[model samples]
Target: MKKLLLFVIVFSVLSAATVTFWAHQPIIGMEEKPIEFSIKAGSGVRSSVEQIASAGVPVNPTLLGFLARLSGKSGRLKAGNYELKPGTTPLALIDQLARGEFAQEALVIIEGWTFRQMRQAVASHPALKHDTAALSDQELLAKINPQYGKPEGLFFPDTYLFAKGASDLQVYKQAHSLLQKRLNEAWGRRDPSLPYKSSYEALIMASIVEKETGQKSERNMIAAVFINRLKRGMLLQTDPTVIYGMGDAFKGNIRKRDLETDTPYNTYTRAGLPPTPIALPGAESLEAALNPAKTDALYFVSRGNGTSVFSSNLNDHNRAVNKYQR
Candidate 1:
């Protein structure tokens, strides 16, 4: 009777040790580099175990399956791409899978970028599921939000994180929603004396401000210039709007003829704000547009450097232009 009890104890200890060894040992051939492993949605633990075994890992599927069940992780494995790096034990991998620790991918939308550029960036990301590539701008917008009248400047400029195989439409929806939320918040806190009739108009002004300067400190000043011009019934005469109006016809340089040419976005020709936003504006630009600096300056010219010189009149603006531009 004592011999039988000793034998059982020894066997149990050996079994526990074996399971520990299997759990701690890293997979074969993946000791030096990371391997991308995927578990499909709705896949059972048995299939996942089989996949690991097939990948040349020296794991006993039956044993691994039993261990997974014992650990209460059999039904908790998530479906997504995972990087099984060197030194990742079988047990660690299982834990990662159970916790839905997927490899995150990032998509960044830069400020001042056009919607077309945003679309191109989305299409170029290899990790994203590309459903919008074949869709037209209108079709894409409809998919993202049916109520959206236009796609331009609707998406917020920020870095969005997603798990692998995430749809482009999902990213677009996130950005669009964020933009709406931010726009509403900015609109609610906007200056009462601002000339913008609606949040959309403020968004348009924000986009203009975003394109006007890269200097963070200058955004409020630039917004003030545009706001002052709008209140005084002065033509915006902004070159960015004219350049946007030129579209494909715009070469690298803006000639005198180009400035004189008329289009819907040509603030020099049109009296008020453009029909739509010219580019995607960041949060700072949006805030600047809503709360402009208190300045009488109406005109500005780029000083050839990143900064610009603000002027109260055309004479000062032309002088700054001649000094910097020439």
Candidate 2:
């Protein structure tokens, strides 16, 4: 009886060792490129193993199953798309699955993009489970947050990561939350003399500043120009606001007639900031709006490049327009 028991123990040990070695071997004929394999959610170990094998990986399902059961990993497999590359072993793949490491997908929201553009981006991502595509703008805003009457510039502009099958609402919620956090932090650190009545007003100004200049160094200066105009109760006379107010009616260019047209968002005609933000503002623009440079400059004009020329009086600004814009 003792001899028979010893034989059984030796055979079991050898069997486990052989299985471990088999699991560690690199799959043959796998090319030097990565291949994507998907395990459906709620898939069992057997089904998952079969799916991996179907992806041209030479894995022994039965032995893998036995090893998984023995190692107490039979029921711990996570389901998602995984990239199987050359030199990847069955053991490594199994370990990855057990740790629930699903592939992440990235979606980027560009700064200065309108909410309409942001919506288009979210609706176009293939990996996301979209729930807002069919909804109208108002309905979508209601779904995201009821307090928000419109969806123009509410979401923060940045790259967001999500697991496969994540809903569009989930992405929007994260962006909205991050925007709120950033806005609050910036508002708390703002210069006390800023003319903004609330954080929302600062966000509106930030959006204008974001759209007005592409140069990072000019942001504070541009903010200061707008601040000076606001303090003097003068017209902002910004062309971007006039373009925004025109909406789809705005052609490729702005004309004198367009600037003279009265609209709530037409800063050339209207007195104060627009009703809401015209585009998404980045962190730097937000900071610049809250902490404008101390300057007497009340106007700025693009120098036909990525930079702007600021002037303290109208004469210099008109001459700059003729020198650069002309």
TM-score, one value per model: 0.90, 0.90
> Distance (Å) between predicted and true CA of 97, model 1?
1.3
Separately for all candidates shown, the number of backbone clashes (residues 3 or more apart, or on different chains) is 0, 0
lDDT of each: 0.89, 0.88
Per-residue lDDT of 1-326 in model 1, one digit per residue for the tens? 99999999999999988998888887645537676767777889999887767765566888887778878899998877777777877788789889988878899999999998999999999999998889999999998887767799999999999888889999999999999999999999999999988899999999999999768999999999999999999999888999998999988899898888889999877899999999999999999999999999999888777899999998998999999998
Worst 10 residues of 1 by lDDT: 27-36
Residue-level lDDT of model 2, residues 1-326, one tens digit each, is: 99999999999999988988887887554666766778888889889888877876567877767767777888998888777768877777778789877668899999999999999999999999998889898898897788878887788999999877888999998998899899999999999998888899999999999999869999999999999999999989888888988999987999999988899999987898999999999999999999999999998888777988999999999999999999
The whole-model C-alpha lDDT of candidate 2 against the native structure comes to 0.88
The most accurate candidate by lDDT is 1
lDDT of 1 at 196: 88
